[model samples]
Target chain A: MNLFKIVTKNMRQRALATTLTGISVALAVALTVAIVHIKRGMQQRFEQSTLGYEMVIGAKGSPLQLVLNTVFNLDISPGNIPWTLVEKLQADRRVKAAVPFSVGDNYRGFRIIGTTGAFGETFGYKLAEGRWFTCSIEALRDAFKEALEHSQERIAKEKGDAPAKPAAHHHNAAEAVIGATVAQETGLRVGQKFIAAHGVEVSPNAEEHTDNPWTITGILAPTGTAVDRGLYINLDSFYHIEGHEVRDAPKDNDPDPGQVSAIALKLRSPIHAFPIYREINDGEEAMAAFPAVEVRKLFAIVGNIDRILLAQAILIGLVAGVAIAVSIYNSMSERRREIAILRALGARRGTIFAIVVLEAVAICAAGAVAGVAGGHLIVMVANAALRHVSGFTVAPLTMEVAELWVVAGSVALGALAGIGPAWRAYRTEVAENLAPTS
Target chain B: MNDAVLSLREVRKSYREADGNRLDVIQVGQFELAAGDQIALVGSSGSGKSTLLNLIAGILLPDAGVVCVNGTDITQLPEAKRDRFRAGNIGYVFQSFNLLQGFTALENVRLGQMFGNGTGDAVELLKKVDLAHRLHHKPRALSVGEQQRVAIARALVNAPALVLADEPTGSLDAANGTAVLELLRQVCTEGRHTLLMVTHDPAVMRHFERVVRLEELR
Candidate 1:
């Protein structure tokens, strides 16, 4: 009786064509939704992981490589800069804080970093169990001083022989702080001991540092960042490990005494970041690079891949639109008698036109809704797998403004596809179609 | 002249053959039907009886003529307005029954009422046509006579002043055809609607008070 009921009945009569067209639209929409979700999620994760650090100073090399090694714990570091440079940066008035990192080791494929406790605080890491390591040389020196004072007092009180001299340096190579992912994957609990290999990847020939096995003194809580996949130990302990120190270096060629992979710097004011970056790159000691700038460059390279995927999604959408057009137009031939009946019943040409177009819109709207839901389901599954493999999480069921535009665009395409069929319906001749069949 | 419910003046309609020859389908100098008139238009195949009915219903436009229904000249109006006028004042019943295939008998009648001046109840009209028991039955489920009855109910649901039936009994067997013709004549008489029907069957001519032969009119 009504236009909607009539349209529904007509579609039901040709269920196969309707379903096929709907599925085509759904496929296009799903691809578009998945692409937009992944691209945005990647950008958000990269930007969030780089927060709180203004610049990274490392050995002269690729800035992107330096950032990837220092921030994301991927790829090898360029080389080690002098530990003295970290101290100098810390002493500078323009630098609010400087955290040193020493890399090139892994525990079962998870990177092991030698850093100070300040590094944990700089990256906002919270301990899940036990306490931070006695990792810094200064902390060890203070502990040694306290132990010496206790022995002297005991000697005086007992009227015993003179107290023995305290050792100048004591390396706590036995202690380690493991990240959440490292603890989960390795099944290493507090007080458990493990040996770290000398390289970033696990290979049969990679040498293990068995001379100084490490105990898990603390475990970090999950932060949804690269930190969740790292193992932290004392800088001094890293140096004391066998085969860690370079034996022979020309004094003139390598002026710095100790080595560190990179220094994470926090500026006194954000405005001072570029000035200090220029000063370090211009200096002979090390090179300075901004993490944000390097991440942008990385995305520019990744953008090419994104463009190809987006084009493929758009092509699928266009093909789906054409499928809708062909399906509707084909059905119009069979519907001529029905259209003429409506015309005889006093339906204007515009009414017939509107009915056809509305049918197309209805089909597309249903497909769009299903596609969006399906896209998020895929994202949820992918997020679970990515979190397990890489310790990175992308939230599922997140909708962006661009996705809304995609839905709108699909509806417009459906309407556009309906135009040809609707025009044919509008031009139906009542007299010819209603001629009596002999 | 004012009492005539349907009138035509100098009506002419033609068609072009495939070989570029012109053919005149219907040509009538003048025609008139009084209020409540029940007339039959008789002709053989290709004699343009159906074409004349279509022109009178405003479903087709004449090449040069005026078709006036219910005291208004439909030929002077634009296509859109003509459709509205036909919907409000003229109803049609085709030989094939032309009942929308998927719609129930009640829905088909209701559809006719939707475009009209909205004056009559569809259920009441179906009951008048003795199809109350088959209100929810679709055209395919009904017998041929029952389907024609539903079509009659649909054509009268708008209470139009003029009803055009193009070979209304042409598709039925002898028994069903006679029954449908009798029912149609009784319904139109009771409603005081002017009836114009086209048919080639001589048996169907007896129910009408006046019979117009297309051969003589041309």
Candidate 2:
């Protein structure tokens, strides 16, 4: 028989211990695989969600925070820049298209984006159902008129005056084009009215719209990323939903409508982004953030987290290796007579060593298979839970370099674990051993 | 005998005690074994009979000696070559049966032929030991006499140039002991294999063609 078959047969001889060792290795493999896959999955999602964005121009704060708020839609904006300032930026020769986003409201944890219909086209968003907002002043008036006809008409009256001109849109009211995720989450369809409020922390019992209700006119399709969880509306409508009202007593009573959470600037070319970024940051009041750079920094942060976890996995993997070593050592004691018999029959010490090493590798391979399968199982369960609870799909297993690294490392660990025992077996004295055996 | 199967010269062996002093176990000046020869090594306790058997089988390295088996000086061979030489030419029978406890009698016999030049048909070998009906029995399941027979079959299955028996019947009663010795003598003589049996029993010594009485090397 070849060395492998003999080692395997002997492993099966102690059915319980061999199986237990295999399971131990499998558990370690599974845990390491899961951690590695999760880190890669999170990083990949970050990359996918951040693609296509060149740069973000916002009021000066943390440049990273500006990127997070604008590209990922994960955090609040870093205050707001004036519309005139954005207009000035659009006028710049290098600037391609400048879209202003006003964010304040959330349906639940999802963001409500207020921008032009051009935002959809620029971002390449396709509608799962319904159409993008027509960006017409008449459409906004009709939506406000419909909200006035709803059950909470008392609050609708408090919406104050409507937009005056063909260009002007809202004074204290707006319309909402429901995102696919938000619509699916709340079962809100076209013509259904819901009070849109500012911030992700609003209470469930709070008046959804204290003054005006926003009608759901459109729903966007899943982008396979974060956009699925967002809501969109017109910039003027966003101000209206936030209860911004211009009064006749113009002194300090008039709230400034020019204030926005952040401004997102799209340059004509990638090469123009750094120049514009420098230009924006050169002004003391605002900071120009490179969404790509900030996103990489974010990955770096998470990378450190992954590194710590990987170190812990290595530690546990070593412990499992030691357990295999101890098990093999103990078996040596029980099988010394067997070794003596082998020696008497003319088997070399090196052959015995190879047999022992082969046995260890076999156990490791079994464990690695079990661990990888188990790790994916964990990912599947976690993905299902995220989908059910958060309606946000998480990838359980994705083909990536990190996963390959884990598999290769696990096999190497198995080989390393067998080294010590194999060495001991090679050095054993045949004469002394055979002299004591029957 | 046409040629001696085993030859030894001026072999010296010692063991280190707990107090760091070396105890001389054996100081044999010379020994030789011819084909079909059954030589019994007889000695009281601590007389180095088992030690001498190990020296002849190439299992132990003497402090000073030349051990030639099948015309090759095995004493000068490296660890791996010496082991190969031993496996091809030596078989060992122990006092305690020394069968791998986990394997059935058939598997135990199969193990004997594992590194040998040719396979030993375990069924036929077991039948030779009158254990064909009990081939499936584990060492733990076999009685002392049956276990010894399985071990004997295992030792001779490889058809080695020399068979080393260390108190092969030491753990058996007189009835079982005599039966085991007769089988060893019969197999060695019939197969033309050199046999070296270590024993304290005078009756067991009678089956050997020659007898070597060991004494403490002082």
Q: Which candidate's DockQ is highest?
A: 1
TM-score of chain A of each: 0.86, 0.81
Q: Once superposed on the true structure, which residue ranges of model 2 sit more than 4 Å away at CA?
A: A1-31, A89-93, A128-130, A137-198, A210-221, A234-260, A284-286, A319-338, A355-394, A407-424, A435-438, B9-32, B37-41, B127-137, B174-192, B206-218
Model number with the top TM-score: 1
Docking class of 1: medium
Which docking class does model 2 fall in?
A: medium
Instruction: Give the number of the best model, judged by lDDT.
Output: 1
Worst 10 residues of 1 chain A by lDDT: A246-255
Of candidate 1 chain B, the 10-residue stretch with the lowest lDDT total is: B110-119
Error of 1 at A57 (Å): 1.8
Q: Which pairs of residues collide in model 1?
A: none
Every model's TM-score: 0.86, 0.80
Compute DockQ for each candidate against the true complex: 0.60, 0.49
